[model samples]
Target: MRRPSLPAWAWVALAAHALFVADARAAARFDAATRVFRLDGERVTYAFGINEAGQLQSLHWGGRLADGDPLGPAKSLPSHSSFDLSASITPQEFPAQGGGVFTEVALKVAYADGNRDTVLRYVSHTLERDAVTVRLRDIALPLEVSLRYTIDPGTGVIGRSARIENLGRTPLRIDQAASAAYTLAPQDDYRLHHLSGRWAGEWSLQQRPVSEGASVLESRRGSTGQQNTPWFAIDRGGSSGEDSGPVWFGALAWSGSWRISIDKDPLGAVRVVGGYNPYDFAYRLAPGERLDTPVFYAGYSDGGMGGASRLLHRFERERILPGGGKPRLRPVLYNSWEATEFAVDEAGQMALAEKAARIGVERFVVDDGWFGARNSDKAGLGDWSVNRAKFPNGLKPLIDKVHGLGMEFGLWVEPEMVNPDSDLYRAHPDWVLNFPERPRTPARNQLVLNLARRDVRDHVLQVLDALVTDNDIQFLKWDYNRNWSEPGWPQLAPEDQPKVYVEYVRNLYWILGELRRKHPKLEIESCSGGGGRIDLGIMALTDQVWPSDNTDPFDRLSMQDGFSHAYAPAAMMAWVTDSPNWVNRRETSLDYRFLSSMQGALGIGANLNHWRDADFATAARMVAAYKQVRATVQQGDLYRLISPANGSPRSATLSVSPDRRQAVLFAFLHSQSKGMQEPAIRLRGLDPRQRYRIARLGGGALPEAMPAEASGAYWMEHGLAVPMRGDFQASGFVFEAK
Candidate 1:
C-alpha cells in the first residue's frame, strides 16, 4: 500500500525550494536542507567557511568557464527588462574563510550565435561575518570580467585581484574596466565614510592616503597582481550596472574603497580590469577554452551596525538566553587575566569567586597561566594539563568551590599554538607550520598549529574536548594570540595551500562545533591577542569579541567608532582599563569608561578585587544604570549624529532607541581653548515634536546629595551641551520619550 502522491506542481515546487535552499551540499552534521547549518564536523559542513561572531572573515570568489567560450550573444536578465547581456565565462564556487558563505548564480541567456552573443550572467551573495556583505553583478555585451579577494597585511583590509580574462574567440577589447558598487540602507546614521589610503596591499583599512576628495579616482599597486596601478572608490552615483552606482572607485584623492579596474582590451588572452583588487579583465573566448580566476567579497548590513548585528544573529544564532537554558550564556561572568594576573594563588581565585557570587556573576573564568608548568607567559601554552604549581590538587577543587559558591567555572585556551619550550612542541616539532628545513618562526611566544595537517587538528580537538568533556568547565575564551606569518604548510599541495587560510579557520570551526554539540550549553568568546581577528567570519562561532587593545574611554571614541563601522556596538567587548593608565597616559574618569564600554558587552578588565570601596560603589550605581539602558542600546537604531573625526573636538553624540520612544545620548567635551566659547551641537534623526527628559548617568552615585554637576537640564531649543572650560570631560544624557 503506497501513500498518495503529491500533485505534480507541488512536487516541482518542493524540488525547487530544496535546490534553492542548498547552494551546495555539506556533511550530514549540517542539513543544508534547512536554512540553519550546524557546523559540527571534521569534514567541511558549512558553506560559510568561517564564523567569527563579531567580524573576522574576509571572503573571496574565483571561477572560470569550462571551455574558452565567451557567452557569445546578448540576452535579458530575469527581472522585467528587454536589454540583455553576455558573459565570457562563469565559475562555480567562491573561496571560504572560516565561517563565510557565497553563491554564484549563472543565467544562460540566448545561445551563442553569429547574429549576437548569448549571455552567461554571473552574480553572487557573500557574507563576511553577519554585517558586511558584497554583491557582485556584471554583464558584457561581448567582454569578459574577473576578480580576486586578497588580504593586505599592511592595511588589515582586503584588496581585489588585478586581472580579468577573455575566454572568447576574436580579439576582445573592453572600453575600460568600470562598474562595481556597494549598497546600504540610507536610514543608517553611519555613512560609507573614507579612511586614508596607505595600505595598498590591503584595501581593508587606511590611515595613510593613496589619494583624497570627491570627483577623483585613486590608484595604488594592486594587492593581487601587484600591478603598477590600481583603483578604489568611496560614495558616488545610484544602483545601476555599467558605471552608475554610489561606490567611489577607480583612481584618486578621495579615500576608502576595495580595489576595481578598467580594461581597454586584450587581444586573445586576458585583459586588465581594475587592478590590485580585481586580478585582470575579460577577453574574447575561443571555443573549448575558458577565462579564469577571481577574488572578491560582497556583504550587506541593514541599519548600519544594528542591522549587521541582526544579520549575524540570523546566521550564527548567538544571543543571550532569556531564561537560563541549553546553548545559552550565563548572564554574569568574571575573568582573571587583568584582575589577578599570573602571580595569584588559589586563595586569590577563591576571594575573587566570593566577590563574583555576591555580584550575581554566574561564572568565574581563569584566563591564561593555569595550564602546564605555566606560572607565567614564558611556559605551558601547548600543555593542557593543569599546572601543579598553580593548582596542586588539580582544577577540580576550584571547580567544586565555584560550583558551591553558585557560579560556573570557565578557562581560556589558545589551542592553535605551541610554545617551543613546552612538551607538545618537543614531541611534534613537525606539527608547527613551516618548511621541513626552515626555522620555526614563533609569534606571541608560540607557533601556529598546522591544522592543515590531519594530526595537528586532531590533537587540538582532543585536548579541547578533554577540557570540556572531562571537567565541569562551562565556558571557554578561545584566544588566537597571533596572525599568520610565513604561512607555508608542507602538508598541503601548492595550489591547495592557498586554501590553508580557509582550512585553518575551518579547523577552528570544527573544534567549536564539537564542543558546542557535546556540552550543548558551553559559552565561548573568541579573542585575538585583543581584537585583530574581530571580523564576521570568526563571529559566527563565538558569542562576542574584544573590540580593541586600547580600552581608554577617550581613545574609545576612535577605536570603538572604527569597530562599529563593520560590527555592532552590542557585540563589542569593552572593559574598564586601569586609570592614569595601565598602558597609556589617557586618564578617563571611571564614569567615562563605564559609560563608553556599556555601549557593548560590559566587563571589568582592570583589577576589580583591588578596587577601592568608592570605585565599587560607583560601579554598582553605574552598572545599574547600564542595566536600564542596555536593552535599548543593544537593540536600537544607531545614528552617527556627530564625529570628532570631522575635526570637531566639541564632542560626538550617539543616540539609540527601539521606536524613538526612548533615547540615550553621549556628548563628550573634547579639548578646551583658553577663551574659546562652547560650540553648539546640532542633533539630527529625531522626532522634533516629541519631548525628552534628561539625566546624567549614575546620578544616584551621590547618596548624600544630587550635585548640580550630576543633575542636568534636558532641552530641545539649543540641543544638549557640556562645559569645556578647562581640560575636557565626558558626559552622558538620557532622553526619555515624552
Candidate 2:
C-alpha cells in the first residue's frame, strides 16, 4: 500500500499555509499543499489531512479553534508491536481493507479477478461553501471512493458519507461498506450510551464503559429494528451527567439493515464505523456504476447528555424533517383503534367521529378494518380497495362527515405487507421475498412484499396514489407489521440476490417521496408494529412516528424519555388510550393519562363510546388546555428535570418555546408512601430577565407560599412547589412571559 512521495518543499509549503490561513467566517477550507481539509461550525471544527503514505487521516474533531490554531499535517502513528502496523494504528478517515489493518475497514471489495483486498489512496478533491468531497482511488485497481463532509452551521453537527464507483470494465462485488469512520481523541475513560429494547418495550437507554474491544449496534431485520436504534453518545467517565459535561453523539440516517461498530484499539484509539450491515449483505456494481452510503451525522457538546440531545433535536427539526426547516405541528388526533378494532363501519365511525369532535379532536383517524376484508390482522392486508360490506358508500361519506365536523380524516394502511389469503397475494404469489422452493415465513399472518422489485414497487405506489386521490384523506398511518423472512430476489441473477437489503429500502423511500410529490397536502406516519422503524432516514419522509404500540401512561414515560434523546418531540406521537391498558392492565386516572400524552404530539385512543359524560368533559378540558401550549411542546427546547428511569417515583419535563416567551411543565408522581416530600421543580431555557405569570392547567391550586407571577430568575432560583400525594397523579403548569 505504498505511494510515490511528494516533493519535500511541497509538504513544507502546505503545512506553513494551513497553520496561518484560517478564516472564522468560512465554513469549509482546504490546504492543497499540505492536503488538509477543515470544516468549521459555530462551536466545532473537523479537520483531516492526507499522510505521507497517501491515506486520509483524521486530525481534529472537537471544540472550535482560533484562526491560527496550529493544526499540523496528519501523521501516521508508529506501530506499537509487530502485530500492530502503522496503517492499523493511524486513524484513517476512510480505511480500506488491504493495509494490514484489523480494527474496522470502511470499504472492502471482491474484484472480478478473485482479489479481495482494496487500499484507497488520495487522488483529488472538491470544496464548497459548507461541504468538501475527497476522491480516493485503489492503489492498483479501478475502484474509486469519494468521501463527502458537510456541517450544519447552527448546530455544529457534521454529516459524512461515501460513494463507491466501479471504474473497471467488469463488475465487482462490495463485500463491506460504511458511510465513514470517526476517530475520538485519546482519553482515560469513555462511556458509551445507546438505546435498546423489544417490541412492546422500546428505547431503553443502555450504557457501558468502552472496553478494549468492539461494541456493535445494528439491525439485520430489514428495517430499523426495535432491538437497537441507530444512535449513540459517548462521554468521559466521572464527568458525564444529565445537564453538564463533554459528550460526543451521532446517528446513522439509515432505516434498512445497518450496523455501527465502536472499537477501541489496544493502543487506546477509539473509532466509530457505521453503514450498511455486512450480515448477508453484498452489492454488485457494473462497469461505470456507483453505490452511495447513508449519511452518518455526528456532533460534539460540552453541556452533557442533555446538551447532546438538545443539539440533535434541533438538528433533526431544522435539517432532517420533511417541512423545509418548519414542519407543521402534530395535530390533536383521535384514533378509533381501541374503540372498535375490527368492527369499523361507516355508521360506527361517524358516531365515533361525532364524539371525538365534541372533545376537540382536530384529526379523526379510522385505524384498521375499513378496507378489504380486514376484519382482523389475519386477512385482507394487501387488498387496498374499500370493503363494500363495511363501507357501502366508500370512505367518502365518513370523510365528508369528519370534515363537516371540522376535523381532518386519516386511514390506516399497510402497503408493504400482504396476507397469504389476500387477493393481491394470490394473484402475484411471486411478488413476495421467497426462494424458488422454500417456505415463505409469515409474521402477524402476513409476508413482506418484495418491494425491491420494480413491479411490486410500482403496484404499491399506484394503489396509494389512487387511494389518496379518490378520498379527501389528510393523513396515512403507514405501517410495516413484519420484517423480512426469506429476503430472496429471484428476479435478479443468483449472484445479485443479496442486494435486496439496499434496493428494498431505496425503493421504499422512492415510493414515499413520489406519494408526497403527487399529493402535497397528504401527511404520513411511519409505524412498524410500534417503534420498530424509526430513524433519521424515515424521519426525512414522514411527518410523525409511532414510538411504541404499548400506550400505557406509565410505560410510555420511560420510552418517551429515551426517544427524546435522538428524535424531536414534533415527530413523536403519544396517544391516550383506555386505562386498564391491554398491555399491562395498568389503570391510571384520566388526568394522569392526558398529562402523559400531552408531553408530545397528543392523541386520544380511548373508547368514547363507553365513556360517561364526565369522561367527555374531562377530555374536552384537557384537549383545550393542550391546544393552548401545543406550539411550545411540539417545537421547543425540552428539559428532563427528573428522569422516570430506574423506578424513580417522580418524573418531570419542561418545554420552553424557542423565543423564550412561554414554558410548559408537566410533573408526574408514580406513588407516594409515608408522605415523602418531593423537591421543587426548577425550569431551564427561560429568559431570566422576563417576568412570567404562572397558571395551572385544569384549574389546580398553586403552592400556598408561591407567588402567581415572578421574574424568570426568581422562579428558576426559588423554584415552584406542586402537590404530589397519591399514585399515578400528574400536574401541569404554563409559565407565560409578561
Candidate 3:
C-alpha cells in the first residue's frame, strides 16, 4: 500500500493550529505560578499583579510578556520630602486625594461634613470572561469605588471606567473623577503624541517630549472642540516610527469637554489619567446615588504607531459603532454644499441630482439654504420649516426626484443652534443659552440652544422626528457650528448652572436615542463645522463623521492620517470637492481628488453642473471601481506603509481584507523631485503561499516593471514598485487571490 499524500493546505492548517493555541493562552490568562494576570492580543500584552499591600502593582505593557516576573515591584522612586510625603514606591492602579502621596490623583471627592480627604484602598476583585472588577473603599468615609476593566477579545483594547457610590447618610460632591489611571515603570525618555487644531484645521497631529511636569490635553469648549482631541500616544526614546517600536495609546469616549493628563514624576515614573474635565466641574451625589465615569480605552502595541491605530480601527468597527441591524455600506454621496451653498432651490437641486445619478452617486444630499430665510449663515437657524420661496410644494418634489434617480436623500440641519434673526429666536429669546444680563455672543450669527432645558430638548426632537417621518428623509447631517462663549442657563439654579455643560450633552444623546428609536432606517452624520464633535460618545449614535471643513486633497491626507489614529475608516466621511481647491486653490487632477477621497467613506462635493464630459466619465468609472473595493477598504486592516509627514514627496497606504483573499494599495506623490526613484510598496496581512492577480484601478500609466501575477510572499517581501511623477498625482491597485 502506498503512503497517503497530504495536500498543501494540510501543512498550512498545522501551522495555523499552533498559532491558535498560543493566541488562546495569551488572550487573557492568569499564571498561577507567577501570580500575575495578563491580557494579550496578537501583537501586544499587558501584565499586572496585586502586591502585599493589597494594591495593584507592577503594571507593564508592551509587545509581549514572555519574560520572567514581569509583575515585579517598582525599583525606583522620587525622594520623599517634608513638603510632599508620598512614600510607597509601587505604581498605583487608581490614586485618590487623601494621604500617601503628592502625585496627581485620579479621583477627588468632598463630603457634606466638609472633609475633602479621600484615601482609597483595594478591598476585593472579581474576574469574568471579558472583564475584571476591583473594589476599593475610602479609609474612613463610607464610599465605594469600583474600577472595571474589560478587554476586547479581538482587538485587545482595554475599556476602563469607574463607578463611585455614596454609602453614607449625607451627600458627597465629586470635585474631580477620572475613569482610569495608568502607570508606567520608571522611564525617562518617553515622548507624547497628541492632536491639536482649530475649526477648519482639526485633528492635526502634534508631538512633544514628556518632561518632569504634567502635560494636559483637554477640551473646555463644551463639545469635543477642534482645539484638542481626547486621545494620545506615548513613545519612549523618540524611536517609534510609523511601523515599529513600543507605543502606548488611549482615547476617551465622552462627547462633552474632556481632559487627559500625563504626569511624569521626578523619578521618571509616568501616570496617565483621563476623563471628564474636572475644571469647574462638580457632581453632587446624594445618599444611595452613584456616578459612573465615561469609558477610557487604552492599549499597547510593539508594532509602533501604525499597529496601535490598526487595533483601534478594529475595535471601533466591531464594538463601538451602532446600526441596530445589518451594517450599511457607506454610499458614494453627492453633497450640494459646495455646489450651491446658500443658493439652493428645488429646480437647481433636481438638475444636480440628475448629474449625480448619471455619475453613479448612491446618495444625494441637499445642503444648507432650503429652510426658512436661510439665504446666508446670518439667519434661519433653529427653524425646521421648508422655505416656500425655494420650494413652493415643500421637499416632496426633491425627495421624489432623488428617489426616482435611485439615490437616497439627505438634508443638512444645525438643530442645536438658533439665529437671533429667525422667528424661532424671536418667539423664545430665553431659549438660547445665556445669562439674564450678559450680552449674547454670536458666532456665524448663531447662538447655542439650551438643550438642557426639557422644553427645548423636546422641541428639537419633535422637529427632527417630523422632518424624517413626513419628508421620508433617509439621512441627516446634524451640525453644531459654534463654541459656547457664555454658557449660562438661567432656568437652572445657581448651584446647577455648571450642569449645562453636562446636561446639554446628555440631552443631545437623548435626542439621538429618540430619533434612532423612531426612525430605525435613518442614518445620521455628526459634523460640527467639521470634526469638532467627533468622539466615542457621538459615534455611538451617528453613522459617520465629516473629518474637516478643509477638503483640499493634500490637506485631507494629513487630516485623514491623524483621524485614523483614533477612528475607523468606515466612520470617516471624506469628500472630493471642486478644485482649484475651495480651501487652498491648489489645482489637482480629477483622478487625484477621487483617489484621495476613496481612502475612507467616499463622497463627492464637487458641483456636477460645472463638470465637463470627460470629468463625468472619469468620475463614473472611478465610482464604479470604488464600489468594488468599498468593503475591503472600509473594514480591512490598515497598514501605513509610508507617511506624508516625513517631508518625502511620496506617501503610501495598504488595506487587507479580513479573509486574506484581497488587498488594496493607495499611493500619492505630492511633488516628486528630480532624479527621484519610485519607492517599493510592501503588502501585509495575506496568505504568503497563495497566488494573487494584480490589477490597476486609476494610476494614469502603469510602471514598466509591473507584473500581472505574483505570490503573496513575494509581494510582501520584495514589494511592488509603481511609477509616480508630477505634483498632486495618485495611484491605486487591487490584488485578488487567484
lDDT agreement with native, every candidate:
0.48, 0.92, 0.84
lDDT of 1 at 10: 70
lDDT for each residue of candidate 1 in 1-738, tens digit (9 for 90 to 100): 984698886765566446433633221111212222122112111122122121112111111112212221222112122221111211112211111111111111121453222222233323222122322222444433333332221111223332334444543322123222221212211223322222111112222222112122232211111111122223312331211222322221111111332211111111122211121212233333333222322223213333332332322222222122122322446777877777655777888787666544566888888888777776778999987777888888888999999988889888888888899988988787776667766766888877767788888888888887878888788877665556666766543343343345556667777777777777778675566454444555566766555666766666655554445555566776678766568677787777777666677666777778788777767766776776666555555556555456755545556476666676666677677766555454456676655566667322122222211122433555554455446666566665
Candidate 3: misplaced stretches above 4 Å? 1-58, 63-89, 324-326, 699-701
How far off is residue 144 in model 3, in Å? 2.4
RMSD, candidate 2, Å: 3.4
- Residue 520 in model 3: shift from native, Å? 1.3
Ranking under lDDT, best-scoring first?
A: 2, 3, 1
Predicted candidate 1, C-alpha RMSD: 13.5
Candidate 1 runs further than 4 Å off:
1-233, 237-333, 356-363, 403-408, 492-498, 675-677, 680-691, 700-718
Query: In candidate 1, how many clashes are counted?
Result: 106
TM-score of model 1 (CA atoms): 0.63
Q: What are the per-model numbers of colliding residue pairs?
A: 106, 1, 1
Local accuracy of candidate 2 as per-residue lDDT tens digits, 579-644: 899999899999999999999999999999999999999999999999999899989999998999
The TM-score of predicted model 2 comes to 0.97
- Model 3, residue pairs in steric clash: 580-585
